[model samples]
Target chain A: MGAVIYDRVALIGLGLIAGSMGLRMRADGLAGEVVGHARTARTREVALQRGLVDRVCDTAAEAVEGADLVVLCVPVGAMDAVAREIAPHLASGATVSDVGSVKRDVITAVGPHLPDGVHFVPAHPIAGTEHSGPESGFPELFEGRWCLLTPLSDGPEVERLARLWNALGSHVDVMEPDHHDLVLAVTSHAPHLIAYTMVGVADDLRRVTDSEVIKYSAAGFRDFTRIAASDPVMWRDVFLNNKDATLEILGRFTEELFALQRAIRTGDGKMLEDYFTRTRAIRRGILDAGQDVDVPDFGRAVLRKGTAG
Target chain B: MGAVIYDRVALIGLGLIAGSMGLRMRADGLAGEVVGHARTARTREVALQRGLVDRVCDTAAEAVEGADLVVLCVPVGAMDAVAREIAPHLASGATVSDVGSVKRDVITAVGPHLPDGVHFVPAHPIAGTEHSGPESGFPELFEGRWCLLTPLSDGPEVERLARLWNALGSHVDVMEPDHHDLVLAVTSHAPHLIAYTMVGVADDLRRVTDSEVIKYSAAGFRDFTRIAASDPVMWRDVFLNNKDATLEILGRFTEELFALQRAIRTGDGKMLEDYFTRTRAIRRGILDAGQDVDVPDFGRAVLRKGTAG
Candidate 1:
């Protein structure tokens, strides 16, 4: 148990991020009270049923009222409307933050709508599963994950929020909004779009039946499916909001793909081998950094057996 | 334990597939003796030390001597030379098979080298981890995985090999060589190429530091790195040997990617959302088929914790 960082923390959207935050905060006594609101009534009901929040409010405006810290956890595209809805209701001196993947677009969308006294700290916790919804969240969802904060201004509020994230088992790093978007573009947005595209291509291939793709997916395609299965609306908003950076990365990806494809066509084994060998080093770096599990097959075979009778 | 399927099984190349096959066969008493041969002395030493083989032969010819089943587990490009080297040494009634990823190429490369009485059954077990080498294998590696056989002729040898795969814990399927190549191109080869290309692009980007990419990979890019981390020589050979089919799939993938990119550029939220929604069904299909574990984040979070303490 940790000391309460905020007397009241309101989460504007009851999806995975909000649900996880509520659960972690409540579990560790990081906040005195956790309030949550969702556009859909069912989400709110589930959020309450799952103990993701101490109180479920009917509206975003109602959720933010009297809250010491307000978090906007909706899709990037919905940030502006939620910001507008909560701005007038936010308590004076309250620190406002977000769990949006793209920072620049979120800042552009939510900054102007905030009241002068309210602190807006745009943040992206670089952690989540393909699963979404309130029920999909767990208290340990953000454990050992990186929480990137792109603050408009540094103050006690930002430090307090960082403390909350730290208590929730995240390492906090501050980055500029533009750099955050570009970094996420390379790490998350572009990879997701490419995965979605490849999975879509596999599904659309008439010769390869869906069952075959599903059955033989363990041969590398399954990884893409897991990634492509992430919340569609959230990913769509990310791509749209971070359009330029995502496209730029994709363009480079295509150019590289063409070069590799040409090597395959021309039977240039050396070039293909060299390129592949280079990428292996990066995977090693990620594992050494503890960003991923070092277990073979991501330990899926073990997981499968563990779930079996 | 199951009855011995073969009097003696010889595994050439002694890499991931061969090592796993050796381990399973020995563990289950499926083969009377599991002998292995690797191109490198270090791999042979590791195979012996790891108990991946009962005996590590210095040369392919010595390993295949008197073996009832000789499995070519080498890279696609090395299939021809290995086949030629072992052709004269193969027993008169021995069954010769392979664990190659691309079927048609293996069939083309290995077909003519076999003796008249030798049974040529080219098999591809669609199972692996990103980790390779002799030490990476486990007895349970093939549990519930699919092993596709592209045989040149139908006989008792083919049925016996299928039974061996089934005993090793894989569902056996038979398909034409060309069709198998195309299906794998869509499911494995092309996806791997795409993952490799994306990782290469991320590494090449001057704006995103390698450290930032590694730290933030859990957002999505880490999955691609796992795929990209696969054995370079094997993947390079896969691309080279399955050129036509892989290139065709890559072409389709690029077209689909461009359409999605345009949607992002033009703010076609509906199209983006719809496409993403459709891809989600494939993931569901994979889970429903039991090809992938339904656990969130592939249960990586749990695995990480398990390893920690």
Candidate 2:
């Protein structure tokens, strides 16, 4: 494997992904200089203190100066503003990619802001932790994880950018941005939404179930609580950016859910058993495929059922 | 705490719960002798080999001999046969209790078999793990957990037995049999069914998404997988026995899910965020209440999340 990818790489937004990028780039000798940008002075200070970046710039435009590669690692809602700010200063022939969860919105938000000479690439690494901030990231977050690239054409710049992620210890996959959104909606967004809903239901169960909630959570509901504990702001933007695809999957999910509810009401054990049995196999598939990144909590937000002071 | 709640303890069904009962009884010195009975020859052998019981009996009748406490830890479907098998040999004044997840059916199945002098207490310890076998038990399984006792006021031995679980590291709450079912339906059964359905949906996804299902499962779906990966036969029995309560909760769950699904379909970010925020508080409640046991797998399955291999 190539020990290094970029001589001078810029990481904008010193949150989980950005910090993780800097850590991995440095740990694997993947970059010589990792310059980072953050709007908040405290976060920038903390990012530097945590050794997440080699250089902390005052602005995104300043961070991208003289950079060969720039990875946009910000919330989807902020993509547009950041893109416009950095576009004017991006070096010619530089490759700009992102690490946003929602792809289509990033493309729409950042595409027009790219300068004529700057090469644009959008990527979503299928990796993260529930904990957010520079302090929470580690060097191995991207190791053996999938970093998806949604390139626009057969440009050598795009392929080279894809190869860069591969060098950073990621399995690179290229797909259409819309398809990426659809797939994620089905696999990720919808599940998180349902988890949020389940946690809400448990919360609304009044005081009686309240006392029993945590004690007996081992029965099943604790899983939802873990997922629902995820960062609220990041998720809010994700839902906002990927509304249509999420809605489509949510519709299908509700339809299936209602049918199962009907089966339960009607005492259809066969149906219930069939559904439960089928799901068990899927869990096996995940275990067999080795997709879970050896993390017991699976990067879930499990503050209570997970970990917290 | 009373070290010996009963002079002798008989455990029917040598699975996780039965083994756990023996381990706990021995660890806490809660029993004079622990006798385990299982119909399967191999289970009996395993129980003996693992020291799950002071003595492994060939029959329920032999197991219940000289016992003041008899805990039915068998599946709900097998309750009656075991109850009847032991009824003929149950010592006079002995208190009979159960650790089944569902109470109503257990009352129906084991109630008729109870001798006039034997007390029948239906108890549900709101805790469990995915693993099921003689060796898949631990002494601390019931520590600080909630155990619901469906009391028959007419029975003295049952009330005495209910007090035993309270002393055995469980916070005991007594309620009518039917009422207990309703509470559990919301707290445990419905959540489990939903988890099962979601996992099934993921399993039924296209080959492409299926391949990435476990890979990106850490994002959310892996939690569902963990819950869905519970013992199939035990879960099957829970739904089958607790049909009324499970169905009622299922109705409410679907109604709530529908409202959320509609909001998602219409691109209502406020509704999603509102629900998500509301749920985060419940997890806090569970923690503040001291219910989030810091054991393996949220106190259900062994949680080896990021645990060193």
Candidate 3:
């Protein structure tokens, strides 16, 4: 086993991210003790029953007491309230971080409530599945994934937090909070909102029944449904928090979509083909960077017996 | 082996769908002979080399000369030209079908060019990968997928075509041409165009570099890239041919997106949450129908060794 990076690590929200972190840390002996707290008693019980933490606390303040590292894994809208609850109980020299998707809003929501001696380092792990809650996490969720840390100060505390994440099988990169928010807006928030919008549109269509959409989803709509099934409360908070950047990207997307729609109306195949070809190059770049597997259909066909070629 | 459904099957345009059909037919001995043709010599050579066809003909007319079953697997835009080329060479009492995504336009474009003795049964297999070309096909590609056949007449010819698709491991359903186009516009055509548009917008963002997007794609944009990377020519033809339905759905999508955008701007979390919750139910319905696998992230983590939980 590896060396323990922190003596006591407190997870403020026992959801997918925190549960995964606890599992990884415990499996690798990366922390001396992993304690967790959730807003609901049922979640706390599940976190304990599932071995996601050594002990479950009923209150956020009780969870953070005497901990050297504290990570907030709540939805973005709840971050401020959790921070306010846990601020008085945090130990001196404790490094506080978060796994929120938006960095700037998280920093704004969480930074003010911390104590003077605590080091506040905001982080966002760029890894997840559509499943949520404490039971949906696995130890390898962050393996080979990128964990972005937007630090307020570059100190030993920040380095220590980065080392902990690295030991959990994630590659850590530090970015400015504003730049990180904007980047995630382009890459994650906008795409998720677009998927949700498209799926909602399909569901709302009177001409096409839900049964027909579900039966023939393999055509292309299946991908959007997978993305749209992500945690609704979390996504709602993400959009509310990262409003500016998401709005900006969506504006550009609508403009580009309108141009393609016009091309279709005018039967301008060349323009549509050219635009599609350029976007294809971006997919090539993503595959080459090892961000996604190169398997066709994300290897879904191979998962079923007798379907692999 | 299964009994031969057709004495000879001719595939005009040796691409993913046609090549897959040839492989399945050959593997199951469902067709006595499978001959293919492509507009380019390279594709014809590859089709023969990959054993996707027993014989490779240079021209569409030569391929369909004595075949009892002729399947046009070309882009929607090229169906008219291919139909015109093979209309005079079609054997008497032969059945002509297609695997085009847009049914109404394919019916309109190829219906007039067929000989009076020929039977035109337009079929669409609601299955594909982002990959294309003859080399990218497999025998199991159509297994457990849906194939919709829109026939001009309910005759023995249509039943024969349906049986052929069933033998190839697909469930066949017959629908009207106009309804098929509108259903596909909601399920396939509009989602594809939206994915392409979002990927294009990300590619055009000046503030975010390509490398950043690629490195951080696991958050959500990876799914969009996979959908956007589909064959440009095929998608171009799909949009051009199904313009009315596609445009109508896109208009509805834009209106919904604007409403969500307004909610985000006004911090109406309840509206956003309600909409997201409703869309999540559709995903649940799709999962229950067995149309998509229920594993997290489409079982992508399982595909990589040492990453599965």
At residue A20, candidate 2 shows an lDDT of 81
- After aligning candidate 2 to the native by TM-score, how far in Å is the CA of A185 from where it should be? 2.2
lDDT of 2 by residue, B136-194 (tens): 77766766778888877756665566666776678877778886777777667887887
Pairs with steric clashes in candidate 1: none
lDDT, candidate 2, residue B283? Answer: 68
Q: Write the per-residue lDDT of candidate 3 for residues B34-137, one digit (tens) a residue.
A: 99999999999999999999999989999998999999999999999999999999999999999999999899999999988999999999989999998888
Clashes of each: 0, 3, 0
Ten residues in sequence with the least summed lDDT for candidate 2 chain A: A293-302
Candidate 3 stretches with Cα past 4 Å from truth are A206-210, A306-309, B206-210, B306-309
- Candidate 1 Cα outliers beyond 4 Å, as residue runs: A207-210, B206-210
DockQ of candidates 1 onward, in order?
Answer: 0.83, 0.44, 0.72
Q: Which model, 1 or 2, shows the larger lDDT?
A: 1
- Arranged by DockQ with the best first, the candidates are 1, 3, 2
Which lDDT tens digits does candidate 2 get at residues A152-188? 7669887778777887768888888998887888667
TM-score-sorted candidate list, best first:
1, 3, 2
Distance from true location, Cα of B255 in model 3, Å: 0.6
Q: Note the residue pairs that clash in candidate 3.
A: none
